[model samples]
Target chain A: MNAFIIADNIISPLGFTSSENFDELKKMHTGVKRLEKSTLSNEPVCAAVIDTNKLDAAFQKLSAKQEYTRLEKMVILSINDCLNQNKNIDISNKKTLFIFSSTKGNVDLLDASLASKFDKKRIYLWETANVIAKHFNNPNQALTVSNACISGVLAIILAKRLLEENKYDTIIVSGADILTHFVVSGFQSFKAISNEVAKPYDVKRDGISLGEGCGTVVVSNNKSLAVTLSASSRAESRDEGQASAIIISGGASSNDANHISGPSRTGDGLLLAIEKTLKESNVKASEVNYISGHGTATLYNDDMESLAITDAQLASVPMNSLKSYFGHTLGAAGVIESIIGIHSMRENTLIGTYNFNELGVTKPINIIKNTQKQEVNNCLKTAAGFGGCNAAVFFQKHR
Target chain B: MVNGTEVYSDSSLPSADFIKSAYKHFQLNYPKFYKMDHLCKLAMVASDLLLKHNPITKKYASEDIAIIIANSASSLEIDTEHQNTISDKNNYFPSPAVFVYTLANILIGEIAIRNSIKGENTFFIFDKFDADFMGSYNNSLLSSNKATCCISGWVEFYENEYEAFLYLVEKEKNELNIEHTSEQLNKLYINQI
Candidate 1:
């Protein structure tokens, strides 16, 4: 029951595809920048925003019309990129399921002026999925998943189940969120926004920098489930033919059951999720080599993650957070970060945890400070968000 | 089979009052209930009733139970409320309390904390009630040894209209008439039983 990720793309400020983003990461490039007198705040605020001019240019190349919203453009572009190279799969087939993951779809529509022109239905998440499906000429009904920060990972978990049931041969998952005044002011109100670039698990870390991006991944069952046996042993399966194939070993979601705005002091919820995922996947904490953490750089999140790692006995594993590079893309963080981790595993590389100067949490933990070349076989991705929700997923490199 | 309930508008009472009456019916004393948005309140009440009398869950570990919830209008009503707050540039006030429930999964958090159940849970937003998805998902979770029992169903709420149907799914049940299937779900859902 191997769910293989065949194709993927990440559209962000640094690049338009997963490979391009990975290249930027190898160079220690960051997209966060301070903006003065923007729509979100009166003073200067730092954020990672996709270049709108470049986005419009890309969207125009996709469609001649100038009607797509910023969010719409990003979604369509990311999904289209993956599907264009994916010739074996027919998105128009009813058996293929399309799932959209986003914390907020067209939330910019909430503005008074945008609200006037756009009907309330325009902001409905389901409608946004419909538009993306229609653009691709896919007849399958689209499903939207809105589970706060863990939406992206949950989508992967759900798609894996759907694949195991043989209901759909292929699942298309796209996750994205835009940085707007509505979101910025909300984070600002909670004092979760740092005036400068955030350093996750760093002594001087203050808050998270809001970011916007979209990511799409194509998932399907391993085509090589059937194979010939020689001496009661099989060399390889058809799906495992690709050297870079990545398989999802296990996924589990849990709730902090604590404060909605803050993470738990004990990190009990994330610990449960990690333990369950490992048990389900038959992987042990001692076997895990890399950790893709949900280090939002906020005081509570980093501290909580340290406690969870120690609780799960994974504190010493090489850990890195893409937040320092992408600045926390909300719903897209899990998918985008997971995609990078998958590629890193294939490339046999470990990325550096950016902006970290010293140990920030009370608990001792392992934070990768520089890029290292190593063979990574098994990696875990974990995220905890508002509403006391947490998700953990495991992945292994296909031989 | 363990529990089924629905809260909607009454000519004599508003939606909020109906939820209040349901809360009082169960004698729920949680102070946070009053602060939650409509969607969360409806879900919290439904789950409270489903698990209140089922003491069988005590036989398993705290993380043995899984929850799967979905709805069409995910925090749409609250989104509108939060929208109104920031709509006015002169009086822009975005409260973190309201912003927290913008996602539908927050209700899952409320129920998990109230009962001390730490298990796998997810929230889906579909255009319509897809019983097929719900049934198959929980089936996999249960069969794959992910959870010994599950609290799974659809919880949808808007400004004036609301409906909730949550069923307890487990391998061994203590005398319950309901079966975990799409057909049974439609039956209970249509009749609002």
Candidate 2:
């Protein structure tokens, strides 16, 4: 019943492929930069946005005749690249299911100017998902997960559940979101968008740096799964000449029930998710090799994570937040960050929390401040979003 | 309404007026209902009715119950309101309250808060009510021991059109003794009997 990661891709400001993004991270590079002026916001803001020209060129190579929204393009390109990595699984097969995860899909179409160009139905997430599914000629209607920031992880969790139930042999999970005036203005109103590149777990961290990106991963049971690692990792493991399959071991979701817009002050909600995930995975807290935190750099979120990590007895684990590198990609954050975590485990390297200077939260936890090589066997990814929702998923390297 | 059968209210009223009247008729005292957007209000009313007959919260632990809800519009009613605020750059004024409801899952949060149900919560979007997926998914949750019971169904609110059909899915057979299947869901959802 193990849901193994067969292939993956990340389309973001830093790079198109997961390896490209990982390489950028290894060099301590970040995508977030101050935008002097942009259509996403009336005032100057900081965000990690993909280049329009680059995205168009990439999509053009796909040779798609029909038109698609920016979010749709990212999703299609991401899934296409992921499919290209491992050609073993046939997406058209009825045994394969498609799941689209996003906080907003083609939500920009809400604009009158944009609505007139595309079918008004494109504004609906389910409709946009169907468009992506139709692109692949997949007969099964794609399932859409729109649970705020945790949608990506939740989608993967759902896939694992289905795979365990022997429902689908392969599941293509893609999570994507694009920067828009709608989201930018909304976060701006909340004063959650940082003025600079976000500094997760940093004392001077002011707010989050919103970004846009897409990430896709192919999850399948052992029947269709294979041991596939990045080229560098395969070369590095040549001494043993062994390939390990990274499995989606277990995951759980919970709610704070405290507030819709705010995280719980006690971190109990997130702790509950983390504890359930650990127990379900049958992995003790001490065995965790690395921790991938949500870390939006907002005052409440970072603090809540620190408390949760400490409370879960994972305070000593080497933890880092990728938000500093890619910005908080919302729906894409869970998948994108989880993909990066897989890469870290495969390469035996830990990407540091970029811009982290001093301890910011009340609790003490080991925060990796610099990219370094480490023997990572298992990684835990945790996310908390608006609506007081929290989710945690565990990934393990199975040889 | 309970199981698609109207318990006590006129369905001919305008969608908004119907929801308001249902709130008054049911005597729901939660003040927060007044501030929610149309989508959340619809979910609140539907869930209130569903739970009124079956208080699953009292029987199951908070973490042992899950909620799986889906719809077509996906909070677009309030999304439009939020979009309108920022559409005009000259008079841009986006409120956190409106911006928060832009996410479809906030309604799930509302239901969770009202019932103190903190189990596995998920919000999905589909073109229409996909009973096959919902039925199988909830069955899997129950069979896998993820939840003892589930509050699962469809709740949609967009423009002035609205419909909510939420039902409780539990392991034990209830008084109705209806089997959980896609066919049963189609029948219950279509006829609203």
Candidate 3:
């Protein structure tokens, strides 16, 4: 049984909706900019912050309660958009599973509660799931994943498994994270924040620019024009195959085992993930049309990722990172990038790697320097996170 | 298959003779790093028990083994303590050492490093156990061939409550045992007798 992404909604620094974001991408526009004067200095002023009040008002029309935090509001709004677009789908009685992908589920609320001694019950992670489920009025089970940067993609894979097993008729996968002082200071302490707008795959690229956004895809057995094909042929096939028609044919997650905060210099873990994904998809490295990398513009990350792709013999695949346009959205990066890749494939165009003039790392891979028109059939999206966790997903246009 | 082991700081830890004797035995026999967290200690103990009389370590490369852990609380007891140092108005600075443990999956990394096993790794969070999800997730990992052997289980720790169980699962050559579905495991562990 194959699973497909029927509809999607995204709220990012680039734009608030899919059409708006796609339009900006078509024009090669970037939303990342210098922080306002009132923001902190060490914090690295570049970020993708959504207007919370506007998001809240939009959600209030769909929800009965209005007390959710910015993170919750983003998720609610994104889900609402997905449901609205995929109208009249009878999820009311189906076992509609909810998979929330977030590194910080209202962690800002937890941070605030620490200072104000607010009610502890309101800040619990489970409560956030409950709120989302209540708003949807679905009977299916709900789960929240907090797997650092890989949470978003992991959630989608989990939903795919659940749907394949006939456990739920509809699976709503949503990822949301907000720029908070807690996250800001943590990245800043590691010197992982860029001073200017992020420049992925560039020789002068410094570090990541933290951004916040929420994105969701409603996946079901229901097929539509928006459906992106899976690389894996069977739900149970384990053999890593060569790259094929941009299907999410097969994928895997692994840890570098070298460092908690840094990727392995050898790209050992990343190679394993890519190999597994290709094997499952039954495709070869030469067949991969493009690679959407987890290029945070950080010195270590880009270097390691470049090495991994090259080692996997995917030297010719056009590679780029969307972080230059929207900054690193942390937990939301995986799904957001996947959505963007799907859009690019659908439009038969390749998005450029923003702010790239000189090649930073010595690798044979072709770095996308400017927006180019191309026929893309298969694309691979990969992300690595703090706990040495790495994930890779393959996408192909549905035939 | 997922495998795991655990240690808990029960009220009688220091005075409990049997537990103390167990600790001494581990100190003399196992690697020094195994003495860190209860989860790691338990993993070492359980792995030793599971690997006993088996050729898994020698037969497979380190990268063939993987660890997937699901937990609640998310190292919160440690997180709260870490936050307290930073929360104080006068000394509002977070500790880098403590902040590292904020993620639940680090336990998997620690275990993999100690065992020299490198494969697929993931940390999942749920309020309570769901047998269906566990079974499906493990099957997914195995079916994908991400790991020839998977060490999967639950490790929950709060201020006073700690519970952990790890199971080593590999694909069975023959037909699966019908009785060992995730529903059965969930009922056995999550639903108390």
Candidates' chain B TM-scores in the order shown: 0.91, 0.96, 0.74
Instruction: Estimate, for each residue in B80-116, the C-alpha lDDT of model 1 and write its tens digit.
Output: 7877887777897889888777788888888878877
What's the lDDT of the predicted structure labeled candidate 1?
Answer: 0.82
Ranking by DockQ: 2, 1, 3
Could you tally the backbone clashes for each prediction? 0, 0, 37
The runs of at least 3 residues in candidate 2 whose Cα sits more than 4 Å from the true structure, single-residue gaps closed, are A223-225, A228-233, A236-243, B3-5
Best by DockQ: 2
Task: Give a tens-digit lDDT track for model 2, residues A1-399.
Answer: 678898999999999999899999999999998999999888899999999999999999998989988999999999998788887878998988999999988988899888998987888998898999899988888999999999988988888988887868899999999999899989988988888899999999999998999999998885334654433357755324433678998999998888899999999889999999999999999899999999999999999999999999999999999998988899999999999999888878899899999988879889999999878888999999998899999999885
For model 3, how many clashes?
A: 37
Identify the runs in model 1 with alpha carbons over 4 angstroms from their true place: A64-66, A116-119, A223-243, B1-10
Compared with the true structure, all predictions reach lDDT values of 0.82, 0.89, 0.70
Q: State the weakest 10-residue window (summed lDDT) of model 1 chain A.
A: A225-234
Residue B109 accuracy (lDDT) in model 2: 95
Show pairs that collide, candidate 2: none
Q: Per-prediction DockQ scores?
A: 0.69, 0.85, 0.43
Minimal lDDT window, size 10, model 3 chain A: A234-243
Q: Kindly report the docking quality category of candidate 2.
A: high
How far off is residue B158 in model 1, in Å?
1.9
Best by lDDT: 2
Residue-wise C-alpha lDDT for candidate 3, range B1-193, written one tens digit per residue = 2222243334555332333355565453655543344444444554554455344657666777777777766666656655565555577676565566666676777666556667877777777656677776778667766677777777776655655666666776423343447876775575331
Clashing pairs in 1: none
